[model samples]
Target: MTVQEQYPARYYARYDHAATQPAPVTGWYDVWGMSDASSVPDAADLVALSAAQWSARTPTGLGVQNGQIVSYAPPAPTLAAQARSALVQAQAATWAKFGSLGKTVTDDWITYQQALSAIADGSNATATDLPSAPSS
Candidate 1:
């Protein structure tokens, strides 16, 4: 079935009118007309229709479905990501050295360097344990 076919008639009608309009109509009322106010589709119906249409038009896995975003989580970090993460951790550790916790920061910096070395050797164990930066 076509994407528009997936939604209710009111939605398809409103979408059809909007898609074809060269200039903005004041509202769906203006497009569908106001001969009988009782026949007007509720705003919510139109909204739902628009959302469904938008999702259908979006490439297969790229948009929201049933109110939740469709997203793919990467299974693992790439080598470049590992390297960048290690650099960020190292920088955080360096900055921490300026605080009162110099020794702890030094330890974390060492750990980050080890992780960076491991990443270079195609190992992810150490990188996985790299500490996050201190808040504030």
Candidate 2:
């Protein structure tokens, strides 16, 4: 089946013709519609489609509809993507641990956070590759 077939665009319609977000969606036009089903759309879910269409992909996979692209959630991450996320959490933890110390955060901790930033998600990096936490 096609990607769209597998993960259809979940419809989120306005409660009325004039309204903004979260007033509560009314219909999902992919299943329901206005005068013509071909005309209106709010957004697209592209994450899985891109990886399917191509072997390589990012966390936000790519997708196109009516000749336009959409960037939203996708399938689960590869090893490198998971590693990158772990590094991000580690970076947050490092900040939380050292934030009140102001200028006193040690050079090693700073370097560790910087190292976390340097690791990209385009390679084979894994969760075990996350930088070691500082003793302090």
Candidate 3:
């Protein structure tokens, strides 16, 4: 079944319109209007639709809608995706099992990287030691 068929837009549109007053039409014609316009543009719902449509049709795993092209998460293969999923799960589990320890580890890692970057760029060198090392 089509995505739209499986999860009908009409159902949501009807539910959205139910609380509002009927629109005025040239007597014989009746128009249904949404009760809350702001509620129609739900971010999560849009994202879910985008994900489904893109996964099925788009080569780049991305799509353009309403004049903008958006980057989408690529659909994964059974093996690589499973491995990545496992890695993410394990990382999350590690963080949960050692919350403060994880933070400490991350903090130390960041500090070490900063120091290494500084040394690599010669930022740790003093002006007095500049003459000892020949200028480039």
Candidate 4:
């Protein structure tokens, strides 16, 4: 089989008990294992298998237990994120004007603000056009 068929890109699990104590219980755990064989265990199957193997020697309601399965993936940032970042940088550059050394630094701050405003309004603005903050 090819790589996709041979291995799942992600696996998921849920827990019936807290893995650690002295804290509020969160009944879920997502495990990623080293290899295909280790990653393939279903949550319920894992629970049953563990119970069978350890029930004779272990106490009731003790040790690890799986509750269910859950899968999750994070989403990408939206256009608003870019606009927000540009706005923040523009505000910082505006503040830098108070400590500006000379006319060049003042002019650079103005150009930087213009570029940032263009980006925040969804217009094309090359980041390279923005100047560094004044050192003096």
Ranked candidates, highest lDDT first: 2, 1, 4, 3
Clashing pairs for predicted structure model 3, backbone only:
none
lDDT preference between candidates 1 and 2, better one:
2
Write candidate 4's Cα lDDT for 1-56 as tens digits: 53334433333322335444222222322233343444444444333223333223
Clashes of each: 0, 1, 0, 0
How far in Å is the alpha carbon of 115 misplaced in model 4?
Answer: 0.7
Better of 2 and 3 by TM-score: 2
Model 2: lowest-lDDT 10 consecutive positions: 19-28
Model 2 lDDT per residue over 1-136, tens place: 4424444643322233332221222333332323344444433422222323333333343333333334433455655565567677766776777675564667887776566556554432443466676777
Task: Indicate the TM-score of model 2.
Answer: 0.34
Which parts of model 3 are misplaced by more than 4 Å? 1-77, 99-136
Off by over 4 Å in 2: 1-76, 121-128
Among these predicted structures, which one has the highest TM-score?
2
lDDT of 4 at 43: 47
Worst 10 residues of 1 by lDDT: 20-29
Q: Using Cα atoms with residue i matched to residue i, what is each candidate's TM-score against the true structure?
A: 0.30, 0.34, 0.20, 0.31
Per residue, candidate 1 scores C-alpha lDDT tens digits across 1-136 of 4322333333322222333223222223332223344555554434343446443543222322333233323246766566767676666657666445644445555665666666656666434443443343
Best by lDDT: 2
Could you tell me the lDDT of residue 11 within candidate 1?
34
Model 3 C-alpha lDDT per residue in residues 1-136, reported as the tens digit of each score: 3333334332221112222223111111001123344434433233233344333443433433332334445343444333344445544554654564644435443344344344435565432221111111
